[model samples]
Target chain A: MTADTVQSGLAAQGYVASPDLAMALHLALSLGRPLLLEGAAGVGKTEVARALAAWKRCDLIRLQCYEGLDAAQAIYEWNYPRQLLAIRAQGDHADEAKLFSETYLLERPLLRAIRQPIAPVLLIDEIDRADEEFEAYLLEILSDFAITIPELGTLRATTRPMVILTANGTRDLSDALRRRCLYAHVDYPDAGTELQILTTRHPTLNHHLAAQVVGFVQSLRKEELEKKPGVAEMLDFAAALAGLGVADLSADPAILQAALATLLKTQSDRAIITTEVAQRLAGKAA
Target chain B: MRGAVTRFAARDPGPAARIAGFMGHLRANGFRLGIAETETALAALATTDCSEPATRRALKSVCCGSAEDWARFDAVFDSFWRNGGRVRTKAVPSNTTPAKATREAEGQATSGAGRTDASDSQKDGEADTGGEGRLIATRVANLRRRDLREVVSADDIRLAETVARRLGAALRDRRSRRVKAAAKGARIDLRRTLRASLSTGGEPFRLKRRRRPDRPVRIAALVDVSGSMQPYARPFLAFLAGLMRADAAADAYLFHTRLVRVTEALRDEDPFRALNRISLLADGFGGGSRIGAALQHFATTHARTHVDGRTVVMILSDGYDSAPGTDIGTALGRLSKRGCRILWLNPLKGWRDYAPVASGMAAALPHLDLFAPAATLDDLAALETELARL
Candidate 1:
């Protein structure tokens, strides 16, 4: 699909991407490269993958990355319990060949994505959290569109799965990893974009209240807060405001305080964004 | 920007020449553009509409190998394409006088023409006008060749940053033990081949071969932020920041009397902002050097977790150990035992008469795989190239 069509499709899925992101996605799809999206936490990096999968009507196979994420967890693992049961039950009749067959193989997200008859969207979320070894492990799969299992040989995808790798930039990625992917850096949206995103996501939210919430969050992001509010937080804040039946998001201390917890995640951030500061931000946003 | 490129194109009337010149300019400015990338970029430009955004998008995808490459590509594209028109706009009066004035003002500030107090600034003024396009290309070339010891002014620092950023992105690859099945390989995948033969009643019809792929070498930067390294630390960290952008697996730590992990701080895209954050975060900044103690601290705390066979530990310091009898040698010995390659970078090595005279230097030298200067942009480029070879 063209950039314009991709943008339209993404918009249909309620995701608003910048021109650069749209272009990057378009190129990635057309060129058959993994799209690497880097951004701060909760800035819709993973959501973009979901939206794409949803738009394309494909299964979204997600691999959530962590500190010690390894190939066994990400790719495939032998069902040891099942194999052991077969061994015990069959006695001398237990076939070693049958025990290590496809029936015994438990496919993880990566392998599942690869083995799908139809191409699926494979989302590797927060890839930077994975250790260097695991990242290195992914290079072969990413570049060659295949996985190797010791027991099962090489499983190369007949239809290439659209791959999305999202990182919060906690750690640097390898050059090999970066080179294999088409890159996009997703940041917090501008005030107008955030406001639009808020209203779009929470269509029932009052326009004035949504603006106030987005503005308040934008102001907070400008501050040196340890954990600034992201779009997800803004949505939560709007939902909270809706719950409170606060239509205008007035600078009233009680109303602001009630919904404030939804936006600020950390105690230090909450401490910094005092009632006084909220009132001022609300007043300014108005 | 598109209008500027269009105007320049109209005057130049040679898109091929202009594009080729831009490619050369990119190469000269340390882009590492391969022949394939150049061909791809050219083909992209040809097939795409000539609109500025489309052109940029096309070239970006085809030409850039990574994010760092994309950034440099954009910067050079802007300068090389727009600056062509900008020179003409300055010399011959344009319809947009205000725009011309604004650009000229920016050019003066960037060019550092008036600040001739420094001899480098004097050289800057000579290349500031008439040959602005040629000037940018030559400036980068000159900056790459100049020694870090000669860099004294802010202008030189800016140039040094540009060079450092380029060097940092040029990361080296290392062989990994991890093997994957390939179409052709040196080793037979017995397990995989056996597994595939199950369909034919244990009669092998298909063969599977495995090949080991090259993995990015993990770079662990231990920068000394002591007073002795004050002059070199900032640029070195900036270089590390560049490496951070290029290689996400790269780790950074700052040490003076203590070792402080600065990997988290260096996540900022802006190196200046990262430096500011580092200053606030690391207590070791501008402190006294305790090389042995810091190495011991790192070895005890972070080494086992971060350093491995694939890791290359690069120490950026002057080798001034505050504690004389401290066993830096033993600490380095421990790190080497972990199978991490050691590279000691001393700024003093940039000096012509410099030697490894310091006690800390003497102790650590035996464990080092590579001992190189970290003082200048040239040294950084050389170091990166040398690492790539290893």
Candidate 2:
């Protein structure tokens, strides 16, 4: 599909994609390559996978990555307890082959995605958190769309799943992992896009309130705070204001300060975003 | 068809030259383009009309393997593809209006017209500047290819420092085998499983696992600063300083007749300040070369703790041992057996058909995985490429 269609399709699923991201997604789909997205935390990196899955009406298989994430967690594992029970029950008559077969196998996200009748959207979130060896191990799966189990031999995908790998730029990924994927960067959105997203995600929020929230969050991102608020924060703040029966962000500084907690998570960040900064930002136009 | 072909040829150069120039610009501006990306880009262009906006998007999506490359690719693509059309359309005669001609000339400059006819531009520049530009260019080329031991000018040393700084980030990291308990791991932690079984009446319900620990690879560089190595010492130290700056975990030692840890002194970002501090701390500077004694010192003090299987130990010297009393071979053998990969960089390796004939070099050669020249920038680039492969 063309980039315009990709953009419109994602919009249908409530994802406001930038032109660059739309083009990247289109190319990734056309070329049948994994789309690797690197950005700061909570910039809708994982949402792209969700939107793509919703757009295609396919299963979204998510594999949350962390340090020391290995093939056992990502692919498959044998049911050790079940095997023990079988050993006890059969008493030397237990079939070793059947115990280690698909009957006793527990499939993880990677293996489940591979065994799907139709291609699913496989989201490997925060891939930079994984170790380099795990990244290297992904080379075989990414390149050939297959995995080798010592007992089961090689399991190739029935249908090649659309893979989306997201990174928060915590560490550098291996060159081998990078080479097998198409790349895109999703940074913080502009005030206009954030406002649009705010209004779209929270229709109960008025334009003035959405603008004030976007302006406050955008200004906060520029501040020397530990954690910056994302689009999700804007949505949360809007929801908080709507729940508090505040029609406009032109409310009192005290009310705005209390509502700001829904956006800023950290204590230091909340301390930094005082009533004065919030009032000043809320008064300004987006 | 013949008329169409002639018109195409008249309006534009072949795609190969244009793509080559674009790729060259990307490389010069620090965009890492792999061979696979280049092949994919070519394949994409073959099946699509490159002038279309969709094709540019497709090309960019395939060509950029990392997010860092996207911004640069966009800038170059916007300037190059658009300017290609503008330049071709504005191919006017010299007798055009002066204002229009000047505007076209400005456009040519922005479009990198000089790079398209680089030789002609160089000739024209030489004629205009009267040999000064050509002289500087020739000197720089010679300095880059010449041995570091023969460098005399301060300008050449400064230029080498800049190149060495760029080469610092090219060192590769090694993975470790030590495992730690993690949320997602390969092997089951039987100990944890047994410990948890007590809570479940000696029957474990959930399985705990362990994963291999990841550590940043350590680099320990031993630079010779004796009288024989005096000429090349500053450049090599600059290279080591750059490496230390790129990797904070890297260790540096300066050895003449003795080994001295200069990691603190060389931590200064300013090359001049770091060099001054190094000169002050190196009391044995320009003294008699003693590779054997220095190796023995490093082995006895720091080898057991710092140098390990994941460590890459680099020894930069001319390999001349003034005092042969201490055994250099034994120290190197111990370091090698400790799992440290030894890489020996000799400044005289490429000069006058040189060989490892020096006593110290011959002894260390058996323990070395890489023995390359450290005499020129090109040699350093080659070393960087080798490290990347490792």
Candidate 3:
């Protein structure tokens, strides 16, 4: 997508368009290299892809990967039950047509992304979670934009899908996969950007109120919380603050705790930042 | 005073907030670097003006490599400004008071000794004591605790921190000695000197010039993995992983009752997963701590296999024994005499009153060249810095 469209679209959504992010996205598109975004979870790596799809007028295809994932699970899986039933029903006269039709494969995310007539922006979310074997399989698809299937032979992409691979750095991705991808590591937004995020997502929030809320959440990140809040949690917190009409620090303790659910995602984090700290923090930040 | 503390805390709220979030747990137990006192220290450092050398030095001293950590302390202190800790917010606190007693300052071992001057360790009485004509010795004495179970909290981060501090102090002593020796004339060896002279002059009389040998220290760590150490195990492994990353001459082994080489396993990116891999490959995750078996196996079998004179074997455990695991002392004595230093790292050593009650502790104490604690994150970091000196 054009830079103007990206800038305006994200602005319309209330998120400030960072020049660094824009440049990285533009460079990835221009070079035809897949973007590898590594960051602490929820630092807007996935959001970048969604935003790109919105600005580019393309469909967004997401492939969620987990442990013990294999090539078949990623590309396509043959309908075993249907094939079994067809073989039994076809009996003596079954022949080639029955066998071929019975073995019809169901397309998975990778094959769908590769075979699409119009390329979509594909997000292989949590790529680090997949095992080494599954990662090796992606190397060819990532580079050549093609995969060899025994049944259907090499399936070539009509157009390369705009790919974004996000990793939480749980494990190191193989050098081969990383070699073909452009990379960036996103960190938590600075105070002003968080305030801007609050304004974008919850326009009803007062300017100072949004800053105070962002400051508190940022403070929470530093405070040895069991599970730290991310950018999404910050936005959720701002929305909560706006919903409660908490324009200033004079809000009741109950109102503050009510907003706690949005920011403190983990029960442990909430418990650690007990009602006392939250109240005191609110008083201090306000 | 209130306004400055508030402002100071506001700017440096990150580490404070983290500690403050669990102040109750720390306060009730009387932990040294409790949330409130850490906040007070954080505030004093933050608002005192970085333009001043003392403030800047304090800032550096308090910081733990992250802006977030600084901010957390600031935020916590800000709340303390509104709340208040055991420390007074007015002016400077007493120099004689133990850092633990000061609200604005957490318990620092060097508090009574005054500010740390990197270049002035000799005058400050923290200099190396051995192998010199004049030795500057300051008693940076051991923590009162002698046993692990009684003093050490099950919490890994806290344990690692305390251990790191003690280990760090000891390391500084070892390093200062080494540096002083390395700085002056280290006498050249003459026996093998003739071998080099025969090649050039066929004359055994002339001394060939040689560089002073700085032998690389080999460090080997063995951690207990019995149920008692379930909490500290992960952080211990993580701290080991960081040491490995620093390319420390270190190898780590885990033992529930049987020792397992976890060197390759901990090489993985994720520390938790690496520990899991060890637990699975070893499966020695739940028996008794075979201190004797572990040490004997290491000394006779392991140390002989990979170590020379400069090796340092570190044992991280509570020293609990179910079996007659005290037999490992003979092997330790053998290893120690062979030029390998045996270090016993007890997490309990950080507490007020700890004793070596276990058979393992009893057996191993006499043989150990150093006894340290690895009970807190700071302890871990200090251990790292100390080793870096070595």
Candidate 4:
């Protein structure tokens, strides 16, 4: 599909992707390569995968990476309990080969994504968090869409899944992994995009309030605070304001401070964005 | 006349030739675009409707690898394509030969450093008298091996920081408390074994095993920022910042007469900003060296929570303590007993005839697990392998 098609598709899925991002995603799909999305936390890198999955009408299989993520956890594992049960049931006539068969195989996200009859969106979320060794294991699967199991030989993908890897820059990802994938740097949305996103997500909300909310968040991001309010946080803030039946941001100072609980994640962030700062942002937002 | 005619023809080259020239320009700007990336970009261009903006975006996705690359792509792209395929004198000077530009680019790319600013190179160009390109190449090579104390230029400091960051990335984590699946391990993985037993009708045929997980190394660095260490402190702090980036559990403290925890300050993504924050926090930075008192303070107050058996306590100091007779050994002994590895990195240790003549150095030397030189970027880089072994 064209970049415009991808952009429109994402927009339909309520993800207002930037032109650059849409281009990156389109190129990734066209080339049939993994797309590596790197950005700060709360920038909605994971949301892109969900949006793509929704757009494609495919299953979103996510493999959440952590420090010790290994092959057994990510790819596949043999059901040892099932194998033992079968052996016991067979009563010394148990076949060794049957134990490692597909019936006893527990398919993890990676394997399950590949083994799907229809191509799915495989989201390897926060890949930088995973160990360097774990990344080495991913090289084969990423490049060739195949996994090598000593027992089963090599199991290639029936339908090549669209792979999307997101990293929060915790550690420098290996150059090998970077080379194999198309790259996109997903920053926080701009004012216009944020307004579009806010209105798209919350259509029933008053247009004036939505604009103010977007404007306030944009200004708040410009503030020197840890963990600037992301789109998700802005949406939450909007929801909170709507739930509270607040009209103007500048009108309810106490309520604005209270509603900031949805936006400000850290104690320092909350402290930094005080009632005065919120009101000031709201005043400018008008 | 033939060479001139070829140059004239090359000025109005084909699309493929233009792309090849663009890739070369990208390479000169440290874009790490190999044949594979070039092919990907070409394939992207072929498949898509090649509008200028669309082509730029498409090529960017294929060509740019890291965040640094993504940031630099537009400038490089615009300079190559928009500027009529002529290499900007600012980027690759008109004066510099292609061979020299390629060598400099290779040096910059392989160093894990970001692109040298055009202005910085212009300054370098202005400074050099004879064999300018060779001098630039030699300078890049020399920066790594040069003493941090002798490193005066801001450019050298930036390069040092980049090398330090790579060194930090190389620092491997030791075995952790968490267990991972293993072929043969001391601990029995009951969860996996029981899960596996399901196929064999309630009979445990396979005993699943697990070993301790390999987690990132926890570093607790106590850097001396005293008056005596003024020349070395900045570079060492940069190294400490690298360690902090590599290991989330890493803690940094600046020590002079008093000990101040700069871990929070150093967590800032921008190294310069982190250093700026640290400068503000380090109240008595240029005071007399009091290694013993600082160690005592750390051991008594901070070590209990921050230091564990797996922690690597890295002390970057010359060991010229103002309080020589005070209890450095006692504090180090306490940390050592807790099973933490204490590494004493003295900048002065790089001297050929260097001895632990200083009373503080002599006193603390016996307590150290590893006492090595931290005089240069190369010396710091060597610690990666040393740390991995530890």
lDDT of 1 by residue, A1-286 (tens): 5677888899899999877788778877776778888767778998998999989999999999998687879988887667777887999998988888989898888888887877888999989889888898899888787888777788888788999999765666776777567677777899888887887798988777788788888987877565778889888888888887887766468878877888777887788888888888888888
First chain of candidate 4, TM-score: 0.98
Locate the minimum summed-lDDT window of 10 residues in model 2 chain B.
B120-129
TM-score of chain B of each: 0.53, 0.52, 0.47, 0.53
How good is the docking of model 4, as DockQ?
0.40
- Best-fitting candidate, measured by lDDT? 4
Query: How does each model score on TM-score?
Result: 0.59, 0.60, 0.47, 0.65
Q: How much lDDT does each candidate structure score?
A: 0.70, 0.69, 0.58, 0.75
Candidate 2, which segments miss by more than 4 Å at Cα? B1-21, B42-52, B84-190, B193-237, B240-390
- Write candidate 4's Cα lDDT for B1-390 as tens digits: 333212335457677766787788776555566888877888889877878789999989988887657765775676555433342423333342343335434543433432222222212111111122224333432122211221123344466556656655565554676778976799999999998776556578889999986666567889997767866755686677666665566788877766767775667665544554465344444556678877876885567556777677889999888666447877787668667888999999988999988888887878888899987667888777876666
> Candidate 3: misplaced stretches above 4 Å?
A1-9, A12-17, A84-91, A101-103, B1-390
Each model's DockQ score: 0.13, 0.21, 0.01, 0.40
lDDT of 2 by residue, B10-53 (tens): 65667765666556544433345666676666655665444457
Q: Pick the candidate with the highest TM-score.
A: 4
Which residue pairs does candidate 1 place in steric collision? A172-B248, A172-B249, A173-B248
Residue lDDT tens for model 3, B1-390:
544442344566575564354343222211123333355445544443333333322322232112112223332333333344423222122232342234233223222332222221122111111112112112221111111111122244234434534443444333223321121245544555567455334456545333444445656778776656655655675456555544434577766555656665556554334433443333324334556766665665456445556667778888876667457667677678668767777787776788886766788788876677777556665555545544
CAPRI docking class of candidate 4: acceptable
Over B123-162, each residue of candidate 1 has an lDDT whose tens digit, in order, gives: 2111111122333433332221111111123344455556
